[model samples]
Target chain A: MWQALYDEVKNEDFMIIAVAEESRGNETAKEWLDLAKPSYVTLIDREHHVADLYNMVNVPQAVWIDEHGRIVRPAETAGSHDAWRSMNREDMSMPEESTAIAAKAQKTYMDAVRDWAINGTMSKHAFNSAQVRTHLALPTENVALANTNFRLGFYLREHGQVEEGDKFLKIAVDLRPESWNLYRQAMNLREIGPNGFAANEDFFARVDALGAGRYYPPPNIEGFPTEAGFVPVS
Target chain B: MVTVLTEAGATEVVSAQATGDDLWFAKTDVTRATGWNLKPEGLCQGDLCVPVPKANSENFVREETVNIAGFWRLLGRPALHDQAGATWMLGASASDRANALQSLEAPDFKLPDLDGKLHSLSDYRGKRVFLTTWSSW
Candidate 1:
């Protein structure tokens, strides 16, 4: 867990730069950050410019850039080695078909991160060279298109154009039927009419576990609490 | 879940089309960025809120005329008008288009430690920061 690692490293003198494009203070997220008491810096990237540099498509992405600022290695989804079930996975029950497939995917992803971290460029998992080509090949053309659509949808939503956002969201969902987050985002915005406000602010903010008002308030509208003594209008 | 807190509360959900101060479209002024309480009580869905007056019985009604024009100018929210009325929605006040990875980055955020000083990403420039975000199973 990056948090666990951050906690371990923050006490030292390491300056951790966490770039986030979303607002923080989700109830639970705040709680954990509090508990960790990290000494490093966490940056918010509302525009996600930093993420563009790292070529990151998701959170928990990491790249070990040396002091010279050169990426010692390409980006990776950081995970602890011990987090894996084990390289020598034996027979496991095929619970539900979906769960079984998920298990397999999880193993592959975990193994990749562990191997990459442990060996670095030399690690068998590093796909920087020819040997890595087989496993580390980039996404195909279709997959790339899907990613683009999803991105466009996000832009539309954050820009307050839900219908346009939904068009891309729909394309993304059709492309990656298995992506949970993508599906979740699309589903949330699908029914949001041009006139409808995202009422799910309660749902999403709570999903992040931050007890707060909706994530983004209507642009420029400032609402505050009235004086307590004054009688409320009916 | 519904509550009948007051007998005189108006239930009609008025959609404001920003035209002018008097008959100004409501949409012209109110935005998602400021807060959408719908109710006069100022109880927005998330952490953000707009201060409005309300009684226990009519939390969702507009008890007072919002200074729509003032907010329109102050916040600079986008506005749209047609022959009949004008409409406005919050602009992307913060983030724009993002990828899964980009969106993964929560906005730059720091909170007061037990000591109460604000903290930020610059605080940890030299050291490696590993921020692990997780969900409860």
Candidate 2:
């Protein structure tokens, strides 16, 4: 999907740089990169620095920065295709109703991206300066604390201190339960018994709790004046 | 293990753990851990300098260690140390955020590519950069 976007906007003035938000360079990353062979710059974010800088709480989030280095659009849900989302919830086998609805509501962010890429700031897809500022989430006290805990947890775990790491990791999850990567990475590394970190929740269990529909935050699609036009999880 | 990335694209490493609210770094490693070195000019990092409070000097710099939380307080930045004393994190001060918002400039940060070559947002100042964050899982 990203490859298609790259090919479509390859001649545009702006550059599309994809960041891998994995904790470290792993085999899956290498395999995907090799298979896709993206022509655009593909960078690795072993420390999730971009996530921290952009306030990204989930994967596949895109932030548009204009020529002046100012963020014209804050992080929002982004996907290149809507093929799978076209299916009706009734046709799906997923047990959770919300999950099925969410799956169906996914939108193609590439349309907005293409418009902005071709037209620059004049694109209707681009939000104005004031709007962009309003859209940006201010760093709250809890967010800052959560970020610190995540960093500490990652650092400890990386240095062969699993028990010590889980202590801080649990606090991080408690602080930012919506941030998927925080708990995702933890679950990937451990079995996480009933007393597991993060409110004793695992990945699948939490998703079930959120209902599949609320898993991904709705895309802040450009030109959608009414909230109804936004991605509908229900 | 703590990794500190300065706005100027410098990276510092500090091996310390929080034993409470206090983060203890080795006395010999304080300078390398934080760009600011202990000196008469207060704690200096490049041209940026912050004066060490006379009252908190002892707590800031112990016999062979530095209390990162205390030192960060002196520098006017926010910091946190884990309960296990196994990790620490520091964030920009309120003033820093205000300045960035006022100037409308994205904060500069450096991250390495797959090959470990560093890339700074400042490096792409003249070009429009689309940064997308994704995960395999």
Candidate 3:
């Protein structure tokens, strides 16, 4: 999907740089990159460096930068919606209605990207500097501290201190509970119990707990859908 | 040995001393771990200098060693470590991050591709970039 969009806008001096935020390192992300066979640049980030720099709390977030290296848009949900929450756990299949909404959401996001790629600063989708700053999730003291603990945790785990690493990882999540990226990545590192289904159930339960919150924050782009079902799960 | 994690990667501060919440390092080790050096004026990096308060100088410096973690706190940056103080991670100050965002410049970072080739965000200057992040988990 990203490759197709890149192909459409590559002629406009536009490039897509996809980063896989995998704590388990290159091997964990290698298979997906190989399967995609992307022509665009694909890098693996083991330390969540990009997430820390961009103040991203979730995955599938994107930032738009212009020719001058200025951010035209701060990190936000790229094209995914929360429709997947409604997927049947047994079959992992989404309902037809949900699938249609998800597809529309993705198309809407892609069209906006194309506009910015072709029109540059003149594009309605491209935000001004002031707007970009307003949208940026500036890190607070706690957020910065959370990042430190996360980095230490990752380092400890990589260096063979799994028990100590888990402690710091837990502290990282506790410091910034709103950061699903931190929470989910930590969960992925934990030793799964014999009941493999426990992890999936825990994830969904957390999603369900966000009764009114969205999993994917609604994009502020013009014409982007914010209908009841389209306001991603938080 | 104290392990200090920075954007440049981890550095082992062999002569570091951890006392309670404070991590003290020799003047040279401070520079080696964090790139900030102590001088007659104050703690400095390049042309930038943060003058240590005359009255509270002891909080940052004691004889030949400087309290590295205290220096970070003095600069309004996060200085974090584990209970054992064996590891430390200094984070960017909130104001620095805010200033960068206010300037609208995308933060530059470098990460390796699957083939171990490094690419920096700044390398793609003079073009439009759609930087996106995802995870398998």
- Model 3 chain A: which ten-residue window has the lowest total lDDT? A191-200
For model 1, residues B1-137, the per-residue Cα lDDT tens digits are 11101111111125442334322224323333244443444434466454443343232233443444333323332222112222222222111222222332322334343334556533444433333222210
What is the C-alpha local distance difference test score of each model?
0.37, 0.63, 0.84
What is the descending lDDT order?
A: 3, 2, 1
Chain B TM-score of every predicted model: 0.30, 0.66, 0.93
Q: Per-residue error at B8 for model 2, in Å?
A: 9.1
lDDT of 2 by residue, A115-189 (tens): 787778898767787887777765555655666676766676777887877787788779888887666655544
Model 1 chain A: lowest-lDDT 10 consecutive positions? A217-226
lDDT per residue (tens digit) for residues A56-173 in model 1:
4444455543222323334444431211211222343323543443344445544544443344455444333232222221333334444445554565466576676667667766
The candidates score, on chain A by TM-score, as follows: 0.44, 0.76, 0.91
Task: Give the better candidate number (1 or 2) by TM-score.
Answer: 2
Best by DockQ: 3
Best by lDDT: 3
Task: Candidate 2: list runs displaced more than 4 Å.
Answer: A79-108, A191-201, A208-217, A220-234, B1-20, B23-31, B37-57, B61-66, B73-103
Give TM-scores for every candidate, taking all chains together and pairing residue i with residue i. 0.36, 0.75, 0.93
TM-score of chain A of 3: 0.91
User: Which ranges of candidate 3 are over 4 A from the true structure?
Assistant: A191-199, A230-234
lDDT of 2 at B79: 70
lDDT (0-100) at residue B78 of candidate 1?
26
Flag regions of model 1 displaced more than 4 Å: A1-4, A10-13, A20-37, A45-59, A80-139, A176-181, A184-234, B1-137
Report the lDDT tens digits of candidate 2 across residue range B28-75: 666766656766766677887777667767776667667766777666
